[model samples]
Structures are given as C-alpha cells and as structure tokens.
Target chain A: MKSHVFRPLLVVIGLVVIVLIARFFYVPSDFGSHEKGYMYGWHRKGNEDEWKAFKVKYQFNNEYCKDCHSDKYETLARSPHAVINCENCHGPAMEHPSDPAKLKIDKSREQCLRCHYPLPYPTSGRANIRGVDPEKHNPGVECSMCHNPHKPNLRGMK
Target chain B: MITRRDLLKKFVKTATGVMIPLAAFEIIDPKKLFADKPFKTDEAKVRWVFLVDTYKCVGCGLCVKACKTENEIPYDANVTRTWVERYVVTKNGNIYADTPKGARDGFTTNRIDLGMGKKQDIKKEDIKKAFFVPKLCNQCDNPSCVQVCPVGATYQAPDGVVLVDRKWCIGCGYCIMACPYGVRFFHPKYHVAEKCNFCYHRINKGMKTACVGACPFGARMIGNIKDPGDPVTKILMTERVGVLKEEYGTKPQVYYIGLDKEVR
Candidate 1:
C-alpha cells in the first residue's frame, strides 16, 4: 500500500482499537440482551435480581394477618368488608410487630369517609356502596365509634 | 489480468465461504449467540395483564395511597405512581378534569378549579355526565420511555413490565419526557426515574398488585394473559375494552372497561 493509504488505514485501526477499549471498560460485564430477543432492549442482568429482591411494603394479601389476628380476620371474612385487606387502612406492614410492635390504626372519620362519602357519581357503581350525607349522619364523630369495621353491617352497629 | 466478471465471482465465493458457517451456527443454537443470561420465569408463558373497570371505580383513592405505601413513595409528594382523575362534562359541551392531590385524599368537592383563578361549582342539573378514571403506567409493549433512556436504564421486563434500573439511571429525565401517559416521575428521595411496575415483587409471589388489592370496589385487577383461565385474559377475550391514546401505537397492556371518549 502507498504511504498515504497506509497512514489513513493505521489511523482508522487506532480509532477502532480506542473505541473497543472504551466499551470494554465502560460497559458492565453483566450488561447485555438476555432471555428474550432484543425487542425489550439491553439491560444489566444484575438489575433484575435487585428488583426481585426489593422489599414491598404492603402486605398484599390478608392471609398473613390470619395467623396473628384470627378473630378479627374471621369477623371481617364473614362481613361485607371481607374484600378489604387489613393493611389497607392500618397502613403497610413492612416491618410490623417487630420494629413498630404495632400498626397505627387509621380511626379517623376521613378514613371511613373515603368510600362512604356521598358523591353523585351514578355511573361509577359507587351508588351501591351505601353512602351517607356526612352532615346528617352524626357529624363530628369517628365512624368506627358507632360502626365496627370488622362487622360493618348496619344491624350490628354499635 | 483478472476480468471484471472473474473478480465478481471470486468475491461471491469468498462471501459464501464466510456466511455458511455463521448461518449454520445460528440455526443450531440461536440462544447461544443471542442471550447471555437465563431468565427465572418462562418468558413466553408469562404475559402480565392489567384490567381497570372504570364503571366500578368509585374514586376512593385507596389504590393511590396503597401504591405510595407499597412503593415507599413519600406521602406528601405530589408525584404518584397511580392517580385518579375526575372528569365532569357539562351540558354546554365543556369538558372539565382535575386530579386533586392525586386523589389520595378522595375527592372532597364536586366543584372543579379548571385551572382557573377560582373553583366553579357545576350544578347537578346542568351536568351531562361525570366519572372518575384511574391512570397508571400502561406498560406498553413498545414503550417510548424504554426507547428514550440514554443509559438503557429503563427496559421492559420479560413479563411486560417496564422497569427503571435506579443504579444505572443517569437521571437525564429523558424517559420522563418520552412517556406519553406522563406516568414517570423522579423519586422523591432517590431522584432516579420511577413509575409503576405492577408491584413486581408482590405479583411474583402470587399476590395482587398493591393498587388492585387496595381497590375496595373491585375496579382494578391483574392477571397473566398467557393463561387460558386468567380473569384478565377472559375479560380481554370476551369484553369490549379500550386503551388510552391508541394512535401512539405503544400497545399498552392495561385494558380499560367502559373507557369514556372524554378520557385522554
């Protein structure tokens, strides 16, 4: 090859080498397209483990509470509120009965009113929820005081 | 001297000589050439699907609160993983919508601020129709957020969930901007890009997503679309469903029942 041709080829080779070296150092070893095809895009293999090991705060199912509070669990199971999880109102049980020793119970009127508040959204299926006019329904009082959440039936209201 | 045809023939022979072996190796073991790591779940067998029955949603905001608590998002932060928007369409064809505090403190008033200086109360008689629609990360099949992440921090998992790698995220806010649904937000404390992942940890353990479990009115649901008997799959197969912003062609996995045309 001529001198000019050789010089340009050498320069291109050097640049390619530099780029390969940079990629080797910059990209993590565990990084690559994995499992499925490249449609999902490249990601570090270790990140999946990190996300899998992530500690979720909410006790997703109420079955966990059944071991500790069987009585309340049974009562709630039989009631219309069976669909409601125990941790939803009491807050997430991330490190409960150990770090805090107790879950803070939400006994505020606002908490109960979240579902019970009367709003005329007829199409939302909220009309079936048995809403009340907060002003007329014993105002300035906590609902848990009169109505037990475990047995939310009106016949058993305290 | 080599003729032009002879030179072309030589080049073709050399190309075939190199290509034959590579094609054979790819055909023999495509996985060996393409994939580096083995996925835990059967990627083909698991397609996570989400369903929202807008008709059943009472806009209690428990799902928002549950998501915040489950994901460790700060309670006071205005950004949220999931939110509920109340839409009020009046008699005169004016559309009004608002998401007050991400509906964390359920809707307290019927009057919408409309981003005006003062809140205007829409009279009950004048209202044509009103409804609440919950919004969350759609987990699109071809997610724009995943496409725009400069560092490849955001990716769609095998199960159709778009996840952000917090450690790898450069916090350029590119993914935040790319998201059509405006679901991505900076983590209040970590400052990395964040959005809903369908509560991956809980769902993997056979529990419902936080938002689904939190909804008292049975408005939200999650199931594997790959399974023949999965409720979400059944709903998708049997019911009339709609997705938001179909014109964008993101192929969102989240399905909506009774989705109103007024909802964006």
Candidate 2:
C-alpha cells in the first residue's frame, strides 16, 4: 500500500479505537434497551428506582388521619361527604402532626363554592350535588359558619 | 509465491469458515449471545388505562391544583401537567376555546379570547353549547416522544405509562417538538424535559393518582385495562369512547366518554 494511504488508514483506525474505549468507560453498565423489545427505547434500569422513591404529597387514604383524629374520621365516614378525601380540602399531608403539626385547612367561601356552586350544565354529574346560588344564599357568611363539613347533611347538623 | 486467483480462493475459504460457525450459533441460540449481561425484566401483570367522563366534569380545577401540588410544579409556571379547556360553540358554528392559567383557577368569566389581543364577551343566548375538557399526557402505546428522544431518556414503562428520566435527559427538546399532543415541557428549575407519569409513585402503592383522588365528581378514573373485570376495561369494551387525534396513530390510552367533535 502507498505510504499516504497507509498513514491515513492508521489514523482512522486509531480514532475508531479511541471512540470505542471512551464509550466503554462512559456508558453505565445498567443502561440498555428494555421492556418487550428495542422499540421501547433504551434507559438506565437504576433510574426507575429514583422515580419510585419519589414521595407523593397527597395522601389518598383517610386511614392516616384516622390515627390522630378518630372522632372526625368516624363522623366523616358515615356522612354524605364520606366519598371525599380529607386531603382534598385540607392541604397536602406530606408532613403532618410533626413538621408543620397541622395541615392547612381551607375555609374560604371559594373552597365550599368549588363544589357547591350551581352550574347550569345538566349533563355533568355535579348537578346531583346540592348546590346553592352563592349570591342569594347568605352572601357574606362562610358555609362552615352555618353548616358542618364533617356532617354535611342539614338533618345531621346541630 | 501465491498468484491472485489462489490468494482470492484462500480468502473466500477462510471467510466461509468464520461465517458458518457464527450463522450456526445465531440459529441455535440467539439469546445466548446477549444473555451474559443481566437485563431488567418487566414482570408487572397490569396494563393501566385512564378514563375521563367529560359529561361529569364541572371544571372546578381541583384536579389541576392537585396535580401541581403532588408533582411539585410551580403554581405560577406557565407549564402544567394537566389542564382543562373551556370550549364554547356558537349557534352559527364558530368555535371559541380558552384555558386561563391552565384552568388552575376555575373558569370565572364568560368572555372568550378571539386571539391577537381581542376578547369578546359571550352572551348566554348567543352560545349554542359549552363544555370543559381536561387534557393531559395521553401516555400513548406508541409514543413519538420516546421515538424522537436522542438519549433514550423517555420511555414507556411495563404498565403502559410513559416516563422520562430527568437525570438522563439532555434537554434537546426533540421529544417536545415530536409530540403531537404538546404534553412535554421543559422543567422551570431543572431545564430538562418533564411531563406527567400518572403519579407512578402513588399507583405502585395501590393508591389513586393525585388528579383522580382530587376529583370530587368522579370525573377521572384509572384502572387496569388488562383485567377483564376492570371497570375501565368494561367501559372501553361496551361504551362509545373516543381518544384525541386518532389520525396521529399514536394510539392514545386516555379514553373520553363524552368526547365532542369540537374537541381537539
């Protein structure tokens, strides 16, 4: 082979070897194509653990609150509001009865009206919820002042 | 001492000797070649599906707020994991749609933006019909985001949920551009690609997604599509459900019971 051709060929081979060595050292051992086939895309298996470790802010189950506030839990469980989660109105219980001690409870008129405002949409299942026109029904007073959230039914109210 | 023809014949013979054994090894046990390195197996038996009953959504925006809080997304950030859009169609067939603050705040005004700094107050009598439709990441069966991700940072999990590895993402923004649904966004703080993962942390613990738990109206639900007895599966089988952008062929898993033609 000619010296010019041989020299360029050696340089190219050296470059290829360097890249291969770099890739071997740089890529994580756990990285690969996963799930069903290569169509799913490549990812590091260890990264899934990072996502799984994430702590959700909202506590879906009411059992956690039951440990601390059994009376309120019992009252809420039997009421019409049984389907509602405690955290839905109260802010996220990520750190409760300890760090912040108590979760912030929303008592604003807008909070009650979020579910109780009379919307004209008939097709929506929200029509089944007992709603009142906020303007007509004691405008300034909060709903909690006249009613109880734990026992939402008027008949159950003291 | 070797002539050109003899040299060529020797090369061919040596090549055939090498090729035959390699071909036989592939034919006999192809997996054995790659089996030396251990790979993670997806043993999950569940296939998750999301159901949205548009008829049941009153657009209170609790789901949006819940998603934001649960995911730690900034309330003031323009990006949202989920949002509700209000669509109002006039009697004359003109359509107007708007999402104010990603519907984090409930729809307060009756006015609709006509675009380019123009707003029109829609009267009750002039409107033919109006409805709210919630939008989120479809978590498609064949996600274009996964396909376009140069670093393979975005992928679909075993439960049919598409996820992004924030650490692995190079912030190329290719996946954001490839997504037809426009669900992907750059994280405000991290500057990497971000989107909804259906609250994977909660679901794996046998709890509902944050948005689903926040909905007081039973408008949003999640169930396993693989289980024959699952409510979502039954509804998908028996009901007239629709997905957004069927023409895109992404095979979106989010099913809507009352999907309207006006919805994009």
How would the docking of model 1 be graded? acceptable
For model 2, the DockQ equals 0.26
lDDT of 2 at A19: 61
Best of the candidates, TM-score:
1
Q: What is candidate 1's lDDT per residue for A1-158, written digit by digit as tens?
A: 45888989978965765565566567787876665445465788788778877787777578888898999999999999898888878888857778568888888887877778766766777656777777788999988888999999987699
Give per-residue CA lDDT, model 2, range B1-264, as digits (tens): 999998997997687455443322323244653553224433557878899999888778889989999998888998899998878788788888988778786654456756678887876667787778988999888888898888878888777788899888999999999999998899998899999888888888888999999887788999888788988899999999999999999999999989899999
Clashes in each model (backbone N, CA, C under 3 Å)? 0, 0
Model 1: number of backbone collisions: 0
lDDT tens digits, residue span A18-134, model 2: 565566567677776666345564678777778888887888678989998999999999988887789878889867866568778878777777667754444455556677877
Backbone clash pairs for candidate 1 read none
